[model samples]
Target: MSSTQVLNHSPFRLEGDFISQLLTNIRTRSISWTSFVKAGCLSNENMSVLKSITSVNDQEDPLSRVDVLIKDIPTYSKVLFDSILELSNNNTKNLDLTKILLVILYDGLTYINSELFESTITDEFFKISKGNPYPPFIEILNSTTSNSNNDDENNQDNFIISILTAHILTSLLTTVPAQQPASSLDLVSLLFKYIQINLITSNKLQYRFLGIQLLKELLSIKSFRNIYISHTEYLDSLINIMLDKNIELQMRYLSIYCLWTLTFDSKTSQLLTTNAKYSEIIPSMFKFANDAVKEKVVRLSISILINFLNTSINSTNKNEIIKKFLLTNGLTIIKNLIERKWSDDELKEDLNSLYELLNDSIKSLTNFDEYENEIKTKHLLWSPCHKNTEFWYDNIDKFKENNWKLLKSLVSLLSDSSIGDSNLTQLYINQSIICYDLSMIIKVAPEVIKIINTMGTKTQIMTLMNSPNSNVKYEALRTTQLLVANSL
Candidate 1:
C-alpha cells in the first residue's frame, strides 16, 4: 500500500493505494491527479488477493477487491470498467504477454459489456457525449472500416458502436443483440425495470439514456407490445420530461424519440384513447413536433398521428384528437418543405421525414374510408402569411422583418405525399373549420389562440385577411371580432 510498493509493481499490482485513493476522491466532484496512463497498470489478477475483513478469519474473498471498486461506484460501474478498457487497448498491438493479458481481460470485459450493453446514463449522457467524442455506427459505415486495433479483427468494433448505446451483444449472426427478435425481449423487460427503479423518476441525467435506448429497441419488437402497453403511466412519465431543462441535446433528442415510439405503439395508442391517465400524454405528443428545431420531432409527430389514425380506423376517439393534428396543418407544413426551393443538408433531411409522413397519411386517408361516421378530411391549400392578414396582427412582430418572412417560407412548401391526395378542400376545411370548432371556448382558451396567433401581428393580420387562402385567418378574425360583436 506504500508509494514504493505502488511504483515498484507492474500493471498487475494489487492493493496499490494509488488507485484506491483517487477513486475515493472522484465522488466529491473532483478528479485526482492519478491518470489513466498510471491506473492502467493495475492487474485484476493481483487484485484477487483482497479480503473481507469482517470475517476476521485467515481467508480472503477472491472478488473482494473488485467488489470495493463497484461498491464505491454502484452508479457508475461503467467508469470503473473503462479503466480495464484503457489497459486492454494499450496492449492490443503488443503481441506478447500483453496480448495474452488482453485476451484474458477481453472475456470479463465482454461480460460486463454485454450486461450493460444497452444501458445508459439517462439524460446527463449528453454532457458525457460532448466531452467524449465518438461517431455512430452508421457514420462509420460510410467511412473506412478499421476504427481501432482492439479485439475486432476487421474493425467490427466500428460496427458495434450505436448512437443509442455502444451495444455489443451478438451470436456471430451479424445481428446486434437487441435486434435478434423476441429472444431479446427479456433485455427489454430487464432494462425497463432498472430504468423504472432509477432514472425514470430522477432529476439526474446520468443513465437516463439507458432507459431511452432500451425502450426504443423494445418498441421494435411486436412481442413486447403488451409490456409497454400495460405500463401506460410509466411510459407517460417518460414522455412528459421537460425538454428545455435537458442541457444535453442528444439525450433530449432520445427522450422525444422514445415518446414518439410510444405513441406509435399499437397497444399504447389504443390504451391512450380509453385510459384517462394518458390523455394528457397523448395530446402532448405535439410539443416536440411544434418546436423550432423539429426534424426529429416532426417525424415522430407523423408516427404518432399515423398510430392515432390507425387506432381510430379500428375504434373511436378520432374526432377529439385526429382532427386537431390533421388541421394543425402540420401536414401542409411538411409538404411545403418538400416543394420549397431550399437545398441545404438540414432541409433535405427534414424534407425526407416530411415526405415519408405525408406518404403514410395519404395511405391512412385512402384505406380508412371503410369505417362508419368517418369525417372526411380535406386537401391543403396553405394560405400564405399575407392577406387581410388579421391573424398576423394578433400574433405580433413586424411583417416586414426578414425573419418573419423567412418563417413563412419554411412552413409553406408542398411535399411529395401532398402530390396525389385529391381532398385539398377537405384537408383545408379540417384545419380552418374543425380546429376552430373550439370556437365556443375561444374566451376560455386564450392560451390556445395566443399560440395559434404567434407568427405575426395586426398589420399582417389585415394582409392575411385578404390573402388568397384567407378562410383560416378570416375565420380567426371573425371569431375575435364576434366576442365584442356579441357583447354589445
Candidate 2:
C-alpha cells in the first residue's frame, strides 16, 4: 500500500481491513509493511495492533512517529509494548525479529509511562537480571542459537540490547514513587552491577562510556548515590578512569563529572580524598588544569578540584590535602594558566574561578605575595615586544587582535586582589594600571568596548568609580562612559 493511501484514511476509519493487510504484509515479509501480527485479525486484537502500527507507518516523518503515538494514543501504548514483548519471547532464535522489536521498544519505552510498565513487570525484571548473561531481560526473550558461527552477531546484539535495556530500566525507575521500594531486587543495585561489570572489566571505551553515562543519569535519582557510595568499587572505578591518561579523552571527561557528583556527599568526598588507591587522581586533575589544549577537560578537572577544596574536612586534614595539591605543581600550573590568554569565550569565567580558588588555597596556608609575585612574572603584561606575547603587542593596526588579550590579562590580575586580604592601596594601584591599559585600548581599538563589557570587566570597572584614587576614579568614569556610548 502507498503511504498516501495510509495517510489519507481517517483515524476512526483506519482499523479493520487495512490492519489485516498490514499484518499480512508484516507476517509475509511484505516490502512496505511497518509492523507484524501472528494470526487472524480479531476486531479488538486488530484494533490494538493496528492503532500502534498505523500510528507509526502513516506519519511521513519516521523520526516523529513514535512521539505522535505516545502523545495522541497513550492509552494504546501498552498494547503496542505487549505485542513486541510477546513476539520476541515467543520466537527466540530469530535474530532479525528480535532486532526489529528492539528498535520499536527503544522508541516506545523512551516516551511511554515508565512507572506503569515497571510496576507490571518489576518481579520479572529482577528475575531476568539474576544470572550468567548480564542482561537477563534480553536472554529471557531470546533462546540461544546453537550455531557457533553467529557468535559475533550474538555478542554485538547482546551489547546493544544490554545498553538499550539499561536505558529502559533507568527510565522506568524514574516515575517510581519515592516511598515505594524499587523492586524485589533493588533496581539501583542491578544497574550498578551491570555498570561495574561493563565499566571496570571491558577493554572497549564505548562500553565504559556507556557505563559512566548510565551512572551520571543515576545520580539524578535521590537515593541512587546512597547505594553507589555503599559500594566502594563504584567510587574507585570512577576515580581510576578519570586519572588514566591512556583512556579516551571523552571517557575521562565524563568520569570527571561523575566524580564531581560524588563529592556532594561528605562521606564520598572523604573517601575520594582519603583513599590510598586514589592518591594519583587528584594530582592528575591538577595536571589537566595546566594543559589548556582540551578546554572542556581542563575546566571540568578544575571544577572538581574546586569541589575538593570546598569539601569540609578538619584543618590539619585540609592542610595535608593542600600540600598534596601543591606537590602536583598545582600552584605553578594555575599561575601558568593565569598568564596565558584563552580564546574561547565560555572559558573566561571558569578560568578566572580556577585561578581564584587555587590562589586562595595557597594563601590559606601561607602569604599571598610569594605566589602572587611568582604568578605576575609568568605573564608578559609589561613586555615592549608585544608580538612575542600572546596578545596585543604589535597589532597597532588590528584593535580586534590585541584588545581582548590585554583586557583578559588585566582583569585576571585585577580579580586577584579581590580574592583575599585586600591591600586597598595595592588594589588601587592595580586598578590604576588596569584602567590605564583599558583607556589606551579604547583609543586604538574599534570593537574593544563590547568585548570588555561582555567579558564582565565592565562591572568591575564600574566599582572603581567610587575609588579613593582620583586618577583611578577618572579613568573608571571615562571607560564606563565610552563602553555605554559604544553600546548605543
Candidate 3:
C-alpha cells in the first residue's frame, strides 16, 4: 500500500498496517536498518520474521512483529527519528507520516523493557541546535493549533502528534541521564512551553493528563525539578490545574500526584510552604481532598499535605505550615475524611494519622501560638485572640522573641500589594485587625514603637489611614494616634 493509502485509515488500523509497511520499507532500503543488521543486533530468527513481512497483508501476528522490533528498539527508534527529522527539515507537513512515525516510536518505547529503554534513548535525542530556538519536534508542536473539533483533520493530527510526542519523551527520560549540558536546557524550556500551550491549556482531557504525566516524568530528575521550581509561573500553572473545578477527577489527581512527588525534595517542600503564590497549594489540596469523590484523589491530596507538614527543616517552618493548614479549615476537612469509609486501608490509616497530627498541633498551640500563626500566615481576622485585651497583654512581650519575628511578619503583610481580589473583604478585615493589634501592642508596651518605626510600620499605617473603607480608616487612625503618643 502507498503511504497515502496507509494514512487514510483509522488510527487503530493504521497502527498495525502502517507499522508493517514502514518496517518493510526500512528493512529493504533504510541505512539505519542496514547498519543494525550488519552489526548483528537482531537474531537470525527475528531477521527472518522481519524479512518475511514485505507486504501489509502478511499474516504474521502483530505481537510477534512487535516482539522482534522491541528487542532492537534503539535501532528502530533511530530509524524513525531520522525519518521524522528528514520530513520536518523538508518542511513536509504530511501529518500522516509524522503521526505514524511518532506513534510507532511511542508504542515501541512503551513496550520495550526498562533496561533496553534506558540504554537506547539518551541525551542525544534531546539536543537543541544553537542556531535554532526549538528542536524540530518542538517546531512542529508550535506550528499546530489546538482546535478541539475532531472533524478538523489538521488540528486532530496536531493533537495526536503532541500527545504521542509527550508520551515518547516521557518514556525516553527513563534512561536519559540527568544534569545534561547547558545546551539541552533550551529543549527543557521548549518542552515546558509546549505543554503549557498545548496540553495544560487544551480543553481535551487526554491532553491535560498526558501533559501532567510528562511533567511528572520531567520532575523525576533533580536538575529538572530545580529548573521547574525556579519558574514560579509554571508552578502556579500546575497549582491552577489542580484547583480547577472544571478539570476532570483523574487530571486533578495526576496534578496532585505530581506535587506529591515534588515534595519528596526538601527544597521544593520548603518553597511550597513559604512562597506566597505556591503556598496556596495547602488550601487547594485541603479543599480538593474535602470535595473529591474518588478515593485516590483524596488519598493523594492528603499525602501531599502530610508531606508538607512532615518535611519542614525546622520547628518554626513546621509550625507555620501546620498553622496555615488549620487556618484553611484543614482540621475540619481531615475530620470529615476520617469519618468516610474508605476501601483502601492505607487511606484510612493516613486519615487517622493526619487527624492526630492536626489535633496534636492544636493542643500544643497557646493563644500566642495562634496569634503568631495568624500573623505569619498573613490571614489576620477577628478571631477571639484579636479581640481579647488580656491576650495582647500577655503576648506583647513575646513578639520580641526571634528578633521580633511575629512583628516583622505583620509589617511585611502591611506592605504587601499583591493580596488577591478574591478576598477583598477578608483583606480589609485582615488589615483592620492588624491595625487594631498594632495599636494595642503600642498601648501595652510603648518601647516597641522604636522597632515599629525602624521597620516603617508607621508609614504603612498612614497609608491605610486614608482608605475609603470606614473600618480600615478608623483602625489605621487609632494605630497612628498610638504611634504618635508613644513616640520616643
Candidate 4:
C-alpha cells in the first residue's frame, strides 16, 4: 500500500470539529487585566481602557470603545501592541489573553495612525534572527509537538494564537508599504501556507472563506505578484479552489478574483502563455465562463481572459494563448456571451473586446498552426483538420521542422500516464488521435519510419493496441501495421 493509504488509516487523524473545539476550549478560559498590569505588559491607563471595553455595566458596544481608544489616545494602540508582544513571550501562562489582545490589535490597526504605527509594527512583526527565519508569530506557529495527547492540546492553543497574530499582521501589512515585508521574507510562501492550512486542511467554511479573503487582499499588493507568479504550486492551489465543484460559489469567485489580480502583472500573464502547466488555466477559465450562472463569476472570468490576451509579452505568446483558448471553443462561448443582455456594462465591454481579439486570432491562424498548437498543448481532439486529406498532404513535411519537434510531442503525449482513470474517455480519444496521426505521417513519408521507431513511438502504439476502447485499439493496430509494412 502507498504512504497516503497508511496515513488515511492513522489513528491520530484530526476530527472534523478540531478547530471549532479548540476555539471553544480557548474561549472558555479567561484572563484578568490585573495580571497584565502587574506583569508590566499593560500600563495602568491601558488596563483602564481594557476595563471600560469589557465593562458589564457599559451600555455602549465594546468595539465603539476600541475605536475611541485608537482615535483619541493613539498611544493606547502602542500600549496594547506592546502588551501583546510581552504576553506572547510567556505564552504558556498567557495564551488566552494574547489571543484577546490580538483581537484588539486587529481592530485598532484598522484605524491606526499610519505615521505613528506603520514603521513600528512593520519592523517588530517582521524582525528576523539568525536562529530563526520566521517572524515571532510564525515562530509560534512553527513550534514542534509530539504525538502525546497533552502536547496536542498545547499545540492547538499555540496554533490558534498564531492564526490570530497572522490576521493582525495582515491588517497592518495591507495598510503599510508591502514591499518592505515582502522583500524581507518569503511572504508569498508564508501567505500561501496560511491560506492552504485554513482553506484546504480545515473543514470549516468560515475559515475557507477567510482564507480566500486573505488571498484577495495580499494579491492586491503589487510587490508580491512576481514572487507569487514564480511558484506554480501556489497558482495551482488557487486554480484547484476555483475549479472545485464542491466549493461555495462566493469562495470560488473570490479565488478567481485573486487570479484576475495576478494577471494585471505582465510577467504572470506571459507565464500563463509559455508554461504548459499554467496554460491549462486558459481552458478552465473558458469553461467556467461558459457554465457559470452567477454574473460576477462570469464577469471576473472574462476579465481575466482579456488580461491574458492584453498582457501577452509578444505576438508568439499571444498566438499560443489564443490557440489554447480556441481549442476550448472559447470563440463560440464569447459570441454567445456577447449576445446576452448583461446588466454590467463592464462585462459587456469585456465580452466585445474578447470577441474581437479571438476573431482576429482566428483570421491569422492556419490549419497547420492550430494542429501544431494542439500537439504542443497535448490536448488532442478530432478537429476538422485532423481528418482532412488536404491538411495532411500539405502539412506532413512541416512536422519535420525543428528536428521533428511536432512528432516528438506526439510521442510524448502517447507515452503520458498522468491522465487519471476518471478521464478514460478523454484518454482514449487522445490515444486514438495520436495513433491515426502517426499512421498518416508514416504513409506520407515512409523514410520517417526509421526516425519514429528510434523515438519509441512504435512501443507506445503497440501498448495502446491492448486498450479496452475499440477506436484506440483499431487505430493502434493500423499504425503498427503501417510501421511494419514501411520497415520491410
Q: Which stretches of candidate 4 lie over 4 Å from their true place?
A: 1-48, 56-76, 91-93, 107-151, 178-209, 420-424
For all predicted structures, in order, the TM-scores are 0.37, 0.53, 0.66, 0.78
Cα RMSDs, all models: 19.5, 20.0, 9.6, 9.2
Q: Mark the regions of model 3 whose C-alpha exceeds 4 Å error after superposition.
A: 1-85, 89-96, 99-163, 174-190, 196-210, 217-233, 244-248, 314-329, 401-405, 420-422, 447-459, 480-488
Per residue, candidate 1 scores C-alpha lDDT tens digits across 30-88 of 22222323454444533232112112221132122222322323234333233333433
Q: Write the per-residue lDDT of candidate 2 for residues 1-488, one digit (tens) a residue.
A: 23321223221111234323432333333222233333321235734554454445444332344444444343444444444445444544444444444444444444333343333223333333331112334343223322223346576555545566565556445434343443513756867877787545567765676777777777766577888889887777777677676876666777877777777786776766666446566767777767637777776777777667677577766666666566456778777776777666655666577566556776554322222222233221232322223233444344354545535655676656442252456555566666666666665664677778788888988988998789779878887887777778
Reference-based TM-score, model 2: 0.53
Off by over 4 Å in 1: 1-187, 207-210, 217-219, 242-247, 273-287, 292-294, 313-321, 326-488
Write the residue-wise lDDT of candidate 3 on 1-488 in tens digits.
22221122221121233334543443233223344345434334434443432223432323333454545555654455555665556544656555545644543444334442444423335532222322556656655544435677566567666666655544544345453446556666767777777777667666666678788777766666766777767777788788777876666777888788788778889988887666567888888888889888888888888888778999888887887777778889999888888999988888898788788887666777667666655677688988788997887768878988878888777646666455677678778888998888787878889898898889989999888779999999999988887773
lDDT of 3 at 188: 69
Q: How accurate locally is residue 441 in candidate 4, as Cα lDDT from 0 to 100?
A: 82
- Give the Cα lDDT of each candidate: 0.40, 0.56, 0.66, 0.67
Q: Residue 410 error for model 1, in Å? A: 38
Model 4 C-alpha lDDT per residue in residues 147-237, reported as the tens digit of each score: 1133466555555665555555455456455334334447556766766754544566666666676677677777766666777777777
